[model samples]
Target chain A: MKQLTVELGERSYPIYVGEGLLNDIAATLGKHRIGTKSPLLLVTDEQVAKHYLERVKGLLEAGGYKVATAVVASGEKSKSLSVLEDIITVALEAGLDRNSAVLALGGGVVGDLAGFVAASYMRGVRFVQIPTTILAHDSSVGGKVAVNHRLAKNVIGAFHQPEFVLYDIATLKSLPDREVRAGLSELVKEGFILDREFVEWCDANAEKLLALDSAALEHALYIGCGVKAKVVSEDEKEGGLRAILNLGHTIGHALEAVAGYGELLHGEAIAIGMVGAARLSAKLGNPASIASETERILRQFGLPVRIPRHLDTDAIMGAMMHDKKFTEGSMVFIIPKDIGEVEINRSVSSVWVREVVDSLKEGE
Target chain B: MKQLTVELGERSYPIYVGEGLLNDIAATLGKHRIGTKSPLLLVTDEQVAKHYLERVKGLLEAGGYKVATAVVASGEKSKSLSVLEDIITVALEAGLDRNSAVLALGGGVVGDLAGFVAASYMRGVRFVQIPTTILAHDSSVGGKVAVNHRLAKNVIGAFHQPEFVLYDIATLKSLPDREVRAGLSELVKEGFILDREFVEWCDANAEKLLALDSAALEHALYIGCGVKAKVVSEDEKEGGLRAILNLGHTIGHALEAVAGYGELLHGEAIAIGMVGAARLSAKLGNPASIASETERILRQFGLPVRIPRHLDTDAIMGAMMHDKKFTEGSMVFIIPKDIGEVEINRSVSSVWVREVVDSLKEGE
Candidate 1:
């Protein structure tokens, strides 16, 4: 097992990524247990409920825990207020106290929503993440969890880290092609902003990854989670260095709003958003070669390199305006300075953004 | 103008209980601003919207900051996830970005709901509380914000401090009598747990307070907020000293759950809970005189000294099984050793509690 620490000071936690982590939870939680509460509330989305929920439940139960399950419907919609209420209610009914733990046992959505609930329930409770998908490699490591509200995605949530994250790559065997591809975006983002070798690794291993080869997937998950763990550790709450994790997310979130969430999985939107950022980087004359190569690698991975057909510049721009990166009226974009290097670029023009988005809408 | 500091090291924030804070928001947001984004989405319940919502809107707008409004139907229900969704959607539709601030402009309900939204939006954004009710005097000072979930109250939320709290005492005139009495419980709590003299002062002045006399009301709000400010500053996230703040909340929360939230205000439930805690403390030989004095004080102030007639002790006990304070099936109570000193008691027996609650029920 490889351990990566998210350095959030006293609020910091560790992310364990490797094969067979699900079984090692007892040992993982042993170090973090404050001995105040026992038993854990396992929070999973409906999709995850089928494959690994019972397995995790069994693990905790066999360890002498009175495990209670709070199964939320898996999707962006599950992050809403009513769902949160239901989850909290389940935990409470199950006799969860402040010392009791909440184990988030799904992908990004489950980790995020459940973590937020734990964060505020009784003014905060301990939580762990047993993430199942590749996309969760990033979400599980970062402490950000929330659901969409009327105005934006992740519009309501919190920045509370978990005590530990058990990222068992074996859990990804059931992941669909699209979901796997979606997870790659965060890896791609980690590489783009923090590490260059990981980007090159992705470029060379795209085919191996597309085939879902165990070795390639493991390597990707490790490196992806590694980069994420490094950045999040440095700046847990996106104070500064943490913002780098949001490389493609500024535009990616806008695309989600314009296209409607679930129209394109978050990774798909971010993949395309990265493309837009790459083009913007080129337009701004920062690192044309790196931008081109990055776009080339994403296209090979079967991730969308362009915005969807129906989404136009106006709607995308409108979404961008709502992003926290938006300053006055301009939105901040992360653009690659070199193949493995990225920089936060805040000077892109709206006219240029519209042009690129419109071009991408017309299928690249 | 009164400036209260909640001194929880990194999580420390100032509570500016004054009018015209909305006018100088820049000064308030001076240090925490990560970027130049100044536009904000003001979230308020209906009750506050009619009074000072536009005034705050005008202030921010006049400060050259673009402002958007997200209003939910007022009351406790507004803190529910459903209402958060509506507000978040409005923020999304209005183009709220990560740097954009969330202004919670109402009572504890709106502050908690909106603060939770602000805590999670874009992994987190800045939020300001412009409290318009007496209850907010307590809620706004702490970083705690949440919505009710099933099985418990405040089952979903976060410990995210607002960028600033603009507590215009002038706004409390519109508050109802019930809310005022309900909020007084907090002040009474501070005295019972941390300052016995403060509690005596409250018992002496509660009548002037009920009349909303300016001096009495101001003093009450100040001392109440001051006690919270001192405790929160020491333990922002309830790791230790912060638990004292919840002296009455644990049993109060159970009462709220069993009594049905709408049946009793938070302060009222806390009122009843405080009485129960005092009884427990007295039985444990911590302070027998204190318990009787507390009951006398609450009764004299027109607060309930007994559990609701329609409530069930078993159910309340069952509900508290979910309080974050419970560890290993043990309920922890923050009970007073004397009039001015509080201790976190973890070894309280359930049998004793049941008997006390049983006896209290019989008397009622």
Candidate 2:
């Protein structure tokens, strides 16, 4: 097992990465002092529930904790206010209290939805994230939990840190091939933001990660989450340094919004957005190779690097205007200076952004 | 104008209590550096909208702010997830951005609903409180914002503080007689939690406060907000010291929920809850005069000190079980030790709470 702590003073918590950690979730929760007295709500999507719900519940119950399960539909659509209300209703009916923790036992969608539930339930409670997909390696580490409104993705959310994140690599063995590749996009995104060596390592071990090899998966997650943990510790609320983490998110979120959130996975949209950011970086006089390298590496991992031609460019640009990143009069973008470094450019021209959006759609 | 600050470290903000501050809403917002670049959403209830909406909007627009207004229905029912969603939709349509400040322009309901909107919009944004009712003196200063679930009041919430709280004493002139009395319930609650002198002063000048004398209103609010500011500063998330701030909330919330949040105004329900807490305190061997004195003071202000007989006791008790306070198979209550101090009693017996509930419903 490998462990790293997000050093947030009193709000600090740990991330645990290893193989077969699910077997000892009870012991891990106990070690973290997540009490058994209050009823625990385990929120997972239907897809994840099919594989691990009953087993995880039995483990918690064996540890003498009362558990309530809420299985939401397995998709982006589940990240809505109506679904959040349904989960809250279940929590009220289950008699969970302020002391109780809401546990997320699925991928990014489950983690985001359940984390918001914990953040808002009784004005915030303890939360635990057990990420089952590679995409969750990034989402579960940071405290940014939210539900998407119809107009934008993750526009309704909060900075709610979890008590601990328990990532059992054994669970990733169950992910579908497309989902695995999509998840790797975010894992590599951490390297693009801050670490050159990690990016090289991800490039070298792409096959092993795609195959879900236990050793490679654990090491990759440890590095990926370490980058996330470090960035978040310094800028928990995105005051300054945190905006760098949104390197590809500005365009990526707009793509998700324009695609109606169901057409493309969050990681896929971001992969294309990273390419766009690199292209924009070159337009700002950085090396053109930055764009090519980002695209090549994403392609190596079987991730999409181009926006679907059918999606309208105008609609995507409109969505960007509604993003949290679009503040003041100009677009705030995370433009890559090189393969391993990025800068937060607050005045990136909307005309330049529109051209990049148009270019990405033209290819492939 | 009398001002006090809720000293929450980096999140600290000022609370301004004055006669006509609402007329200068633009200056106050600009003073707080709530910028004019992004659009602002002014959330008011229908009742408050009829009086001050146009004037406040004109002031903001005249000062160069693009303001969008959302007028929810008046009363407790407005504090629901649906209303929160509706406001968010309005914010989206109004082109609100991350830097936009959500200005809560009514009483507690609007503050809570709008504040939650700001807190959850794009994972938190800038918020400003422009309170138009006396009850808001308690809710606005504490940074405790929430919406009610069908099952319980404030079961869904966040601790999102504002940039500043702008309370206009002039607005209170329009409050109905019953609302004035109800709002006083919370104002005096600040005293019961910490200040005996203030309680005595409130008792002595009840007529002035009831008659909307601006001088008495400013003094009372300054002191009331001061007590709340001190308590919240010491414990922002109710870790230990802050629970005492819930002096009567355990029963108060339950009564509000049982009455469907419509029958009893928040302060009125809390008034009865405070009386019940005093009775429970007496049962726990405190002075009997504590209960009588509490009831006498609340009655002096024209507030109800008894639970309505029509509401079912079992339903109220059941609601208490679902409250954030109830834990470890015991009722967690804030019981008065005397007229000016309270303690969080975590092991209070359910039987004793039942007896007090039964007793309170017995009288007029």
Candidate 3:
């Protein structure tokens, strides 16, 4: 097992990366003094609950913890105010208190939804993340928990960090091919924003990683979580350095909102968004080769490189205008300077945004 | 003007107590660097909007702000999750961004609802409190923002402190007689739990305070807010010291939940809860004089001293058992030791609870 600690002073927690760690949840959580006597709420979605709920519950119950389960419908729709209200009601009905801890056991949707549930339950409670998918490697570690509104994604949320994140590579075996590719998009994002050599490593090991080989997946996730952990520790509230993590997210979130959440997976939209950002960077005088490289890498991962033909460019622009990241009326975009470098620019012209988005339209 | 600061380190903010400060909204907000160019969302209720919305908007606009308004329906129902969703959607439609500020321009409901909105919008933003009711003297300063769930009051919430709290006694002139008495209940609670002298003062000047005399109300709010500010500064998240501040809240919240929210105003329910706590404290070996004194003071302020006959004891106990403060199935109660001292007792027997609650029932 490899462990990395996200140093956030009193809020610091560890991320455990290894194969078969799910079975050892009790022991790992115990190391952090999360005892069997503590009331535990195990939140998962239908899909993940079907596959691993009992197994995980049994392990904790065997360790003397009384586990109460709340299984939400699986998908982005679960990240809504109404769904959050239901989770709170369920948690209260289960007799969970401020001393109780919530264990989120699923993909990013479950993690985000459950994390917010824990965040607002009694003004905040300790929660652990047992991520079931690769995409959650990003969401679970950063502690950016939220529920979506009808008009926007993550419009209502908080920056509540988890007690710890426990990642078991064995769970990756159950994910579908599309899910695996979605997870890699974030791992690739970590590399693109911080470590150049890490991107190169992912490019070389794509096949082994895609196969869900324990060793390759563990190494990729460890590196990905490490970059994220470091960034979050430095800027927990995104006052400055943390905004870099939103490199493709500005356009990416706009895409998700325009496409209607769940229609386009977060990672898939971000894959296309990263491409859009790269094109904008190239137009703004970054080397053309870097933009091509981003496109090439996304395509290699089976991720989309262009905006979907059905999406309206004008609608996408309108969506971008409402993004929470926008301050006043001006929009900020994270432009890639090169494969391993990026710059935050608020000076991107709308003419350039329109031009690049127009260029990606169908039959152009 | 009288001012008290809630010292929360980097989250510290001031509570300004006076008459006619609402007219000075622009100057005060500007002092905090909430500039004219910053986007502003003025949230109020239908009733408050009818009287103060345009006035507040005009003041902010005159100070250079581009203001937008979201008027929610008046009453506790506005604190529902659906109402929260509607507010967020309206704020987004109004083009609020990360740099924008939400000014809650009414009583406790608007403060709690809008504070949560600012807390969750874009992960958090600066919000100012323009509390127009006396009850807000308690709610606005502490930053305990939340929207209620169907099953529980403040069951879903966060402790997001505001930038500043501006209390203008002038607005209290328009409140109904019942609302004025309701606000005083919290003020008396502050005195009962923390300052015996303040309670005596409230007793001496009950008529003036009840009449909403500027001098009396300002003094009462200042002292009330000072005690609250001190307690909150000592314990921000209710880890220990803060629970004392919930002196009347455990049972009070239960009352609200059982009464179906709007049926009982928050302070009125708490007035009864404080009496119950005093009775419980006396039964637990405190002097009988304390209980009598509590009943006397509540009666002096036109506050209810007993649970309504129609309220089912079993239902209220059921709600209390689910309070967020419970730990390991043991309920903790803030029992008043004397006029100005309280003890947190976790060993109160359920049998004793039943007896005390039954004693408060009519025809007993």
Candidate 4:
């Protein structure tokens, strides 16, 4: 087993990465048990639970854990207030305790809903992520778990880190093609913001990784988690530099909101969001000359560049205001001055934003 | 107005205590609005909702905030999963947003429940406390808001600091004597764990402060918030030294669980819990003696020294295992060595705990 630390001082926890890490799940949770009777609960969405929930439960029960299960819907819509209450009520009715660890097993939706449940249930409880999707490579690693409120996505959440994250890449083989494509968006993000060489590697290794080539897939997982772990270590709560991770997300969330969410996967939204940002960067006259190159790479990965029809420009602008990063009403855009460098620049003008929206409309 | 900072770096926030803080509520919220749609949903219980909800809504609406209201049943019981879901659903249906702030207008239960909803809604939103009870003076000011999970008190919560805390002490004038005593338990925790001078002051001026004398109340508020703010600044998430703040919470929580919460006020349970802790501290031979004096001061404040007759020892022990602080089954006891000295001790034996229960049984 390979272990990485998130380095959050006291809130710090470990992320265990490797194949078959899921096999020893019970003994793993035994370490985080605080009280004598840790009435454990394993949370998964309906989709993932159909295949793997019983196996995970067996491992914990075999280790003598008194456990329970909570399963919700299997998509972004599941991240509503009703689902959160349902799971919380389940845990309470099952008599789960503060010392109890909530094992989130599914993709991003389950991890987030379960993590938010852990973050607020009994003030806070231990959360363990057994991320099943390639997209969870980012969401599960950072403690950014939350359910969406009506007006925004992830608008309400804490920077609560998990007790541990056990990423089993094998789980992704069962995922659909669209989901696999969605996962690539974060790798694209990692390449754009923190490491350019990693992007080049993704370019070279995309096919093998797509085919579930173990070595190639491991590299992406390792590098994606590596950059994310470092960033979360530096800023667990997004006080300043951490905002850079939202490089594509700012525009991406707007895209999702305009397209009415679930229309575009988180990564697809980000894929186009990155393009919008890249275009804005090129227009601002950067020294790196990073316009055509990024567009080509995105197209090569089969990522979309088309902004959805029927989406109003002003509506997207309004949605951008909902971002937690923005101050009062003034915008804080995390624009890259050059590739391999992202800055959380708060002094951007709305006029510049309007112009970019206009320029992109004609170009795409 | 007296202002103090919690000093949690970026998570750090300010506390405003004095007369008519609710009147200044709009101005305080103005500084943290994420958009022009800076409306608010004022959350309170049925009790405080009748008294201060309309007044607070009128103040905010008059000051130009698009205001709404959400009221729940008032009590510890209202902190359940169902109530939380109800509030989140109400807020969502009412168009609450990231730009919107939650004004928690009631005592500790309202502040904690509403604060938690803010902490988990859309991931999170900003919350401002318009505390209408004396207990809220301590609970609200420090940013430690939470709800009671089934097995333990304050089991589900987040360390999401409020955007601002408004300690309207004038609200304390209507507090019942029992509630006033309950609030003082936290105030007393500060003195017993960190401040000898404050403990001495409380012993000297408990009556004056209880009378709601402005000068005496201000002193207690200052000292209570100052100690908690300082501790929270150094350890916002209860990593290490923050555990010292637990002072009597472990045993106090156990007592409350055994006595069936709401049967005994939290402060009353904590008072008995402190005596139990003092006895354990003396037995541990950790030096510095004030076990007798601790009991004297608690009795003087009209607090209880024995767990209620309804409680069973073994049941209470089982409940402690569910405490958020429980590590496995062994208790993490926070014992007072002297008036100003406390420590978070791990692996407290169950054998000794039985002795403390036996000792309490002999007394009132």
Candidate 5:
């Protein structure tokens, strides 16, 4: 097992990465002092619940904790206010209290929804993140929990850190090939943001990561969560430095919005957006190879690096206008300067962004 | 104007209490460095908008802000997830960004609903409080923003502080007689918590306050907000000492829940809850005068010190079981030691609480 802590002072918590850690989930929660007397609500998706819900519940129950389960539909649509309300109903029914902890036991969607439930439940309670998908490596750690609006993605949210994140890689063995590749897009994004060596390592071990090799998966996730923890620790509220983590998110979120969320996975959309940002980087006089390299590495992992031709460019641009990054009449882009480092450019032109979106639709 | 700060270090903000402060709302927003370039959303209910929304919007526009207005139906019902979604839809349609500020322009209901919209927009945005009712002096200052679930009041909420609290006593002139008395229930609640002299002063000046004397209104609100500011500054997240502020809130919230929120104004519910707490204190070996004095003071202000006989006691007790205060099989009550002093008793028996509830239905 490998562990890293997101150092957020009193809000700080650890990320545990390993295979078969679910068997000892009870001990990890106890170590973190997660609510034993107050009832715990374990929120997961229908997909995840079918696989591990009963085992995890039994483990927690045997550890002397009373637990209730809320199973949401398994998709992006589950990240809505209505669904959040349904989960809160379960929480209220379960008799959860101020000291009660909410345990999220699925991928990014479950993690984001459950975390927001915890953040807003009685003005915030303890939260535990148990990420089952690779893409959750990004969303689960930063405390940026939210639900998407019809007009935009993650438009309604909060910065509520978890008590701890328990990553059991044995769960990832159940993910399909497409989901695995999509998840890798964000894993490699960690390297693209601050670690050139990690990016190279991801490129070298792409095949192994795709095959769910335990050793490679553990190492990459530890480093990915480390980068997220480091950036978030320094800028928890995204006043300045934290914007770098949104490197591909500005364009990526717009794509998700235009595609109506369910059409493309969050990681696939970000992969395309990362490429667009790299291309924009080159348009602003950075190395052209950065764009080519971002595209190459993403494609190597079987991820889509191009926007689907059928999606209208104008609709995508319209969605960007509503993004958190679009402030003061200018687009904000996290442009890659090189393989490992990025810069937060607050004045990227819409015309330039439009051209990049148009270009991503072309053949290669 | 009398001003004081809720000293939350980086999240600290000022609370300004006076008459007709709404006319200079833009200048005060500018002083606080709230967004000018970013669009602002002014949220009010139908009742408040009829009087102040147009004027506040005009003032903001005259000061160079792009303002959008959302007027919810005027009542406790506005504090629901469905209504919150409606406001977010309005926020989206208005193109509100991360830098934009949400200005709540009514009493506690509008403040809570709008403040929550700000707290959740883009994982949180800047928020400003423009309180137009006497009861708002308590709700607006503490940063306890929320939308109620069908099951409980404030069960879904967050602790998102504002840029500043702009209290205009001039607006209180338009309130109905019952509302004025109800608002006073909370104003004197501050006195009941930590200030014997202030409680005595409120008892003496009740007629002046109810008659809308500007000097009495301003003085009372300033001191009331001061007590709240002092408590919140010490414990921002209610770790320990802050629970004292829940002096009557546990029962108050349950009463609101049982009454379906709209039947009883928040202050009225809290007034009854306060009397019940004092009675509970006496049962737990405190002076009997504490209960009698509390009921007398609340009666002088024309507030209800007894629960309506029509409401079921079982229903109210059930609601308390679902409150944030009820944890680990024990009822948490903030009991009075004297007319102006209280203690947080976490292990109060539900049997005692039931007897007090039963007792409250009988006499004045």
Candidate 6:
């Protein structure tokens, strides 16, 4: 097992990466002082619950922890205020308290939704992340937990870090191909924003990593988490350095909002967004080769490289106008200068954005 | 103007207690770096907006700020999840951004609902509390912001402190007689749990304070905020010292929930709850004089000293069972030993709670 700690002072927690760590879940929780008598709520989605809920429940119960389950629908829709209310109500009904702990067991949706649940439950409680999909490697780590407002995604949320993140690679075997690709988009994002050699490493081992090669997957996730952990530890509130993590997210979030959430997965939209951002960088005199490289790498991973034909440029721009990144009518975009280098451009003109977005039409 | 600072390290802010601070609202906001260009949203209720919204907006506009208004209904109903969603949508529609600030311009309902709105918008934003009610003196200080859930009051919330708290005593001049009395209940509570001298002072000047004596009111608010500020500074997240601040809140919240929020004013319910807690303390071997003196002072302030006859004891007990203070099957209660001293009893029996609650009936 390989372990990395996100050093956040009192909020610091460990991320455990290995195959078959689920069996050790009880001992891991015990080490964190979560005893058998603690009121425990395990939040998951229908899909994840079907495959692994009983196994986790048996392990916890065997270790004498009385666990309650809150299974939400398995999609982005669960990241809504109504769904958040449901989880809170269920948690209350289960008799969870400030001293109680929540264990989120699923992909990013479950992690984000459940994390926010724990964050706001009686002004915050301890939560553990048992991420099943690769995408959760990003969502579960930073503690940027939130539910989507109808106006925009993650506009309503809080920065409450978790107790620990326990990732068992064996669970990845159950994820669909699309889900695996979605999770890798974030890994590629981590590499693009901070580590040049890491991007090269991802490109070299893309297939092996895609094939669920345990060693290759483990190395990618570890590097991805390490990059994010370092950035987050430096800027937990995104006052400065952490904004870079939103490299593709400015345009990416707009895409998700315009596409009417769940229609386009977060990672898929971000894949296209990263391409658009790179194109904008090239238009601003970065280098066309960098844009092409980003497109090529994303395509190799079976991710979209162009804006969907059905999406309207005007509508996407309208959505971006409401993004949290915009301040007093000016938008901030994270532009990739090269494969592993990025810069925050706060003065991106609407006309330039329109030109680049309009130019990304299929077959344009 | 007399000012008290809630010392929360980097999150510390001032509580300005005086008459007519609202006239200088712009200058006060400017001192906090909220200038003309800051994206500002003023959240108020219909009642407050009818009297003060335009004044505040005009003042801000004169100061070069582009201000937006979101007016919720003037009651506890506004502190619901749906209302919270409405506020977030309004904030987005108004083009408020990460750097934008929200100014809550009413009583506790507005302060709490708007504070939570600021706390969750883009993870969090700075919000100023311009409390217009006497009850707000307590809510504005502690930074315990939240909306009510259907199952309970304040079941879903966060401890997001304000940038500054501006209390203009002049606003209290417009409050109804009942509202004035309701606000005083919290002031009396501050005395019962922490300062016996303050209680005596309140008892001596109850009539003058109720008649809107500016000097007496300012003195009362300053003392109330000072007591709470000291307590909150010692325990920001209620790990230990802060629970004492919830002295009457355990059963007080239950009373509010059972009465169907807004049916019984918060201070009125807490006035009764404090009496019940005093009774419980006496039953658990404290001096009975403590209970009688508490009842006498509460009566002097025109606050209810017994549970409303209409509220069901069982329903109230059921509500208490789900309070955030409960852990597993056990409940924690703040029991008063004397006028100014209290202790947290973590092993309070439900049967004993039932006996005390049942005995508090007006007819009994």
Q: Please report, in order, the local distance difference test score of every candidate based on alpha carbons.
A: 0.77, 0.91, 0.88, 0.77, 0.91, 0.89
Model 4, A74-100: lDDT tens digits are 888888656876777687667675567
As for candidate 2, its clashing pairs are: none
**lDDT string, candidate 6, A93-194, tens digits:** 888877788899999989888888888888898899999999889988989999998889888899989999998999998889998898899899999998
Off by over 4 Å in 5: A362-364, B362-364
Among all candidates shown, the one with the greatest DockQ: 5
The candidates' DockQ values read 0.56, 0.83, 0.80, 0.35, 0.88, 0.81
i-RMSD of all predictions: 2.7, 0.9, 1.1, 4.4, 0.8, 1.1
In model 1, which regions exceed 4 Å deviation? A34-37, A72-77, A257-259, A308-313, A362-364, B17-37, B48-51, B54-65, B70-74, B174-178, B203-207, B362-364
Q: Which stretches of candidate 2 lie over 4 Å from their true place?
A: A362-364, B362-364
For each candidate, give its TM-score against the true structure.
Answer: 0.89, 0.98, 0.98, 0.76, 0.98, 0.98
DockQ of 4: 0.35
List TM-scores of chain B, every candidate: 0.92, 0.98, 0.98, 0.95, 0.98, 0.98
lDDT of 5 by residue, A1-364 (tens): 9999999998888899998889998888888877488889999999999999999999999999999899999999999999999999999988888889999999999999999999999999989999999999999998999998888888898999998898999999999888999999999999999999999999999999999999999999999999999999999988999888887898898888888888999899999999999999999999999999999999999989889988899998998888877787888889999999999898988899999999999473
Q: What is the C-alpha RMSD of each candidate to the true structure, in Å?
A: 3.4, 1.5, 1.4, 5.7, 1.3, 1.3
CAPRI-style docking class of model 2 based on DockQ: high
Which should have the higher lDDT, number 1 or number 6?
6
Q: What is the lDDT of residue B239 in candidate 5?
A: 89
Docking class of 6: high
Ranking, DockQ, top scorer first: 5, 2, 6, 3, 1, 4
Residue runs of model 6 more than 4 Å from their true location after superposition: none
Candidate 4 lDDT, B1-364, residue by residue in tens:
7888888767678887787677777777777653337557789999887778778888777777787778988788987656876787677666675567787899888888898887777567778877887667667865677767564577667777887777877777778888888788778778898899999999999899778788788678877888888888888767778888777777787777777767877777778888888989988886425778898988888888877665787887777666667655567888887888887878788789877877786344
Q: What fraction of the true interface contacts does model 2 reproduce? A: 0.86
lDDT of 3 at A95: 79
Superior by DockQ: candidate 3 or candidate 5? 5
Which residue pairs overlap in candidate 5's backbone?
A: none
Better of 4 and 6 by TM-score: 6
- Cα deviation in Å at residue A79, candidate 2? 0.8
